[model samples]
Target: MKRICFLYCMIFVFLLMPNIVGATQSRDDGLSQFMFGISYNELLDTGDIRSHKAEFLAGEEIQGVFEEYDTLLYDKKNGYMELHLDASPCDCPGKITAAAYAKRNGGYLFLRNKETTCIYRHVNGIVASEPITSYMPVGFGLQMFLPEHFSLPKNDEAAFFLTAEIPRQGTTTTLQLKQIPFGLYVPSTTLLIDDAPLALADKAKEVEQINDPQLSLENGSFYKTYHNIHESALIFFDPEQFNDEAYPTELPKKELQDMLLSGNLSAIGEKDRHILEKLGAYASSYPPITLEHMSERFRFFYMVYQVEQNLVWDTCTMEWDSVAGRFRITKKWLSRKKPASFLEFLRDADFWVAAC
Candidate 1:
């Protein structure tokens, strides 16, 4: 009986050893990296790659190289696996080296330069020929990495690539290819806005303000001020600062102003519309008010109120830009979902309202 028990213990130890070693190896491997499809388009098509900066850590260095562009071959290499890109120059000098690594779990690229690193995931396809013409001016730089993990697409075959046109005099020996795994996806988690009913008086007052004409000027000062005030309100109400007492029946004017100015009001709920309506009315009734006044004011207020009530979630914020006359909402959690306007927000409200 003693011999049988000892054999069972040995078997269990043998089975567990591989798992322990694998976990340790994975940790040491670092985080994954890739060039997203969007980044490629922006860098190659629009020539705006420089605007998207990358962050680099100390003791890390990145260099660029030039190479012949071939779309079919590029697609073949990247289509099977998920790819992401960090940064690229608009043009390369000669024999541009497309720097990249195998996408793995919990892997990242670190650079010796202390620069910001912007990552892009590979979507599909590559340029068959270099985008820049010979002798034409081209920008070239390397994206350095910080010691952090980044999310990679799930498919294993995809690879992220970045190219830079290096002058004939450029150096290639500095380029390094490292392999790392994709990291866990972390959502932009936030507190849910409390849903409570709005006050009657506040609602009536906003309706009244909506009828004011002077404030609605297409390009008038009041219109601008009204838009600015509502814009400020969104900033003030940050969901992160919510405590039990933060939402009360009566909010002071100064408190509301503070919230608006702070640009933290990303999570105000519809049940809280009554308070917002009252606030809008109060703003409209200020000195130099006119009939056209409340139109733009009311429009902007309602837009924000609707956004807070209907679109905003724990992981995102919805807002309208009066200057551009468009609604914009962002959900970092739903990476695939594109940024939407007010109408788009309503049309796709169901997609983002889920609890993940």
Candidate 2:
């Protein structure tokens, strides 16, 4: 019985040894190791060109960390590997030539600048190169590649890094690295205004007005009218239209004459009128009507009070024509305004600034 028990124990240990060894090997191999690249296409192209000076980095830990990937290939030559960097000007145009390199050993990579000879190591696929002292007519940048065998460092994490160096009248170089989580996806949704579905007609009209090819005087009549109304609280006056003494007077007397001819103005219903009136009243209170002074407009200005942050202030302006029973609201009218309670609008503007 003792002899039989000993033999069974030996068999059990043998069966478990391979799995234990495999686990240890995996830990040593640094699973999910990260690698970064500037652009994949450039790296692949570098590989096709067979440029020895260039290199490529590959590992599993790199994903969303690098913003772009370079296209390059690796070929083994006499117990070592050589990278080929080639440039095709038609597709990609930019300064700075970049490449990534890695050896079979897990140690980090160090790059030496030919001129300055300053050395830097690759940190999570980001390597900062020394400044360019030599004068080159063209630009230079880095191109990096990521290997497929590498996996994400985490389930859904991403990171990015950017660097740029431009010499006076010499070559300009830029490098960026990005890593993202594995198997990530995002869904699209319909855009809404004032908690209501945006009308396709209005959207189409906006697109047409923005992209109209003709640059004639009539083409921008409505836009010009809107700007004048916002700045002076009046229609296109004599002094605003043109400086020509022969045609000093305003050209169009009717409210919709020039706008209708320009295909920018259209008929509106009572509901639209009510909305415009409310928006106009809100916009008239703000000052500094310059284009850069406007704030981000909200569909429901009142709802801003409910947000946790007090950054909901906005301005809304509209131009009303009592004679024609028509009005127009300019995009600038839907901007945010500073509140008097926040120390003369200074504090309020600071609150609304988005985080970098």
Best by TM-score: 2
User: Model 1, 1-356: lDDT tens per residue?
Assistant: 99999999999999999997666422112211132223333323322223222411121232221122311112222221111223333221112123222223332221111111212111111221122121112221111121123222122121122122211221221211111111101111111111111211223343244344433323333434444443333423334333235445344544544444334454444544454544344445333422123233333333332323332122223232333322233321221343344334323322100010
Q: Best candidate, lDDT-wise?
A: 1
In model 1, the runs with Cα more than 4 Å from the true position are: 1-211, 218-221, 232-237, 241-247, 250-278, 281-337, 340-356
Error of 2 at 182 (Å): 38
Cα RMSD of all models vs. native, in order, equals 22.4, 22.2
In model 1, what is the error at residue 154, expressed in angstroms?
40
Candidate 2 similarity to native, TM-score: 0.18
Q: Write the per-residue lDDT of candidate 2 for residues 17-96, one digit (tens) a residue.
A: 99966654221122112112323334334333323333323322211211233332222121111112123222322222
